[model samples]
Target: MNAQAKPSLLAKFGDRYAVDPNKMFETLKATAFKQRDGSAPSNEQMMALLVVADQYRLNPFTREIYAFPDKQNGIVPVVGVDGWSRIINGHPEFDGMEFRYSDALVTPPGASAPSHEWVECVMYRKDRGRPIVVREYLDEVYRAPFKEGMKGPWQTHTKRFLRHKAMIQCARLAFGFVGIFDEDEAGRIAEQSERDMGAAQVVREQAKALPACPEEQIEKYAAVVESGQRPAEQIISMLQTRYELTPGQRSALLEVATTQGDQA
Candidate 1:
């Protein structure tokens, strides 16, 4: 007899949105994302993407939401402009929105085109007492061309990008949308996080290469713990950077610190 195929996590919805989760995943695997290495998104990645899509009621088949690999071996859910528009306007309490543009234009440090000084978005919610307003400055939000000198939408459609930034910020404040990011913002954050994690790993490897703590130094630390001059955790962390500590040494230090702390 043949084994049964397990249903996808999205199967719980049972076509409520008229989407077959497993079929959609199979289709998206071939089309949604074009990786740098020409690889398709993994099943796990597709599942994660679907979860976020379901949460926000976005249609991945229409490219409303997509996935990007994150530093911590997870996915960053990136929403399209249309997706943002749908979510904001679809909110039950969303009353209306208005935009304000700056009179002056200025070119940012790295931008290829000049943009308005700022754009502001004011979003009103029927349930709220006051409207939520957010201002985005072109100079601050402008994205420069890639290192290869290729210009992105920010450089080509400066005003639109500025307006989008303002609207997204305003919506976040008004609606409390969390864990979703714009494409550019998601890329930058993921890359920066990966770099930070890589640096942290290097530091950890260097710390692990350090010599074991000397018996005399360990005794000195135990004495300090007994005296309650410094926190046990703090001293242990400091010592860890310079030397490897055994479990027994850590336990002994904790015991001494506990004894001293109890007496006080």
Candidate 2:
């Protein structure tokens, strides 16, 4: 197929490439809230997020998470395929090098989408560490893949494919931060699965029958069910300080509690 007519490279991998957005958000939040004294993962983390978004055909909004030494000449938050490639390969052109994501947690407001976030990393000259101007490459300049016998050397082709796979996996995991599979649809499907297996009805009935148990017995049972340890007499004694319960209700409570314990 011609370059413009070719399917997205990401689509060939399968649906597993898609990410749960909610989970992605949670992971991003956790990473951002971590202590700031440590070094940040910056490029690696951003690459992972992009990989997932690309696989899912989701467009993430780029927000600046941070600008080192202020934005005038520093690296700023950016996105798109080129940005991801630059971070991963550490080169603007396909130079046959391999790269891996780092494990640093960067502070946020560096760049965030409705679903994920990223921190900015300053680009510096290798020898002097002097800042370099970050520029966005135009689509034409990057050269459409498979065009004009423009393929890189054999090593570059192999390494690029490998890196793309790695990015897809990382993106899948990062997608969890955004609640991708945590929606009502997933919940409904889970409930349906349980019902199909005859588990949901049993649990519902057990819960409904729990209220007739005696307060003391129910408290003892609840404690054991919740904590995996039998309640002490003192713990049981404290039950009467609160609400009342009936003997049958206590029996039901014990059944429900025991059932829950079994599940746990």
Candidate 3:
């Protein structure tokens, strides 16, 4: 493999790789992704897998990484636990890795239970002064209500998956290979993952659906506070009463109000 030349997908992994799109499509053809009904994973998905594999030096055949068609649009490339290991361990300056897990949750039978402790993965790189660390609980990894049919990681292997989640995060940080989004973070992003998003006290459902209040709205809210008129409370009352804003809408309005008032 020439340093200047792009490596071929059909060809084995080497230095300076770029996806051979045609070869990747061909590779996908032989997989379960190829429908017995003669359907196939979309071109977009195949290309996504190809680009990801090329950049990460992953081989789909070996299951270094693969697309899970069960999810929405089926474009999400799920890196195997091996994929995280490969990328983190394969780096030139790689040092080593470590992991830790908390005790299991003590919920009653068939009750909603969180993991005992958040799992942590730390990756050391020779060049960087400190290790890259990522911590996540079972809840952080899976946001959707655990379906009846699907095996929940919390039930099947919560600690294992959480460890894998942390490793994936550390690998992404170490390698800066972000061509694919972590499937864990795909459904929703969480700064604090413990809360029940479905609960009204946590947040209004409609408010969650609404996009962030626009920049202009925030600025306008700030200006109003600066004027010392139509206090935040009064404004919120109006939005709530007049517009009959859903919990989501009221939350958005309140957030903007608070943000602006804070500055004032």
Q: Which candidate ranks first by lDDT, i.e. highest?
A: 1
| Cα lDDT over the full model 2 | 0.37
Residue pairs clashing in model 1 are none
- lDDT of all predictions: 0.83, 0.37, 0.61
Off by over 4 Å in 3: 1-24, 32-38, 69-74, 103-115, 142-145, 148-150, 181-264
lDDT of 3: 0.61
User: What does candidate 1 score on TM?
Assistant: 0.71
Residue-wise C-alpha lDDT for candidate 1, range 116-188, written one tens digit per residue? 9999999999998989989999877777777656767887788888999999989899999988899888889
Assess the local accuracy of residue 176 in candidate 2 as a C-alpha lDDT between 0 and 100.
24
Worst 10 residues of 1 by lDDT: 8-17
**Per-residue lDDT tens digits of candidate 3, residues 1-264?**
657874454454322235464554665656723543466777666666777787788767677776654322355566666776777678898899898776766332233455545778888888999988888765555443356555554455555656777877777787686755454553333322324433554456554554544446545654675466767667656444334444664565567667766887
Summed over model 2, clashes come to 34
Candidate 2 lDDT, tens digit per residue, 1-264?
Answer: 556774433333233336454454444434531223443435445445445555444444332121111112112222333434334344332223223333432221211211111212233333333432222211111212334444432123333333333442333332222323211123344445656657767766665665433456665566664565653333334543443455564555566556765787
TM-score for all models, in order of appearance: 0.71, 0.18, 0.55
Best by TM-score: 1
Q: What is residue 110's positional error in candidate 3, in angstroms?
A: 4.8
Q: How close is candidate 2 to the true structure, as a TM-score?
A: 0.18
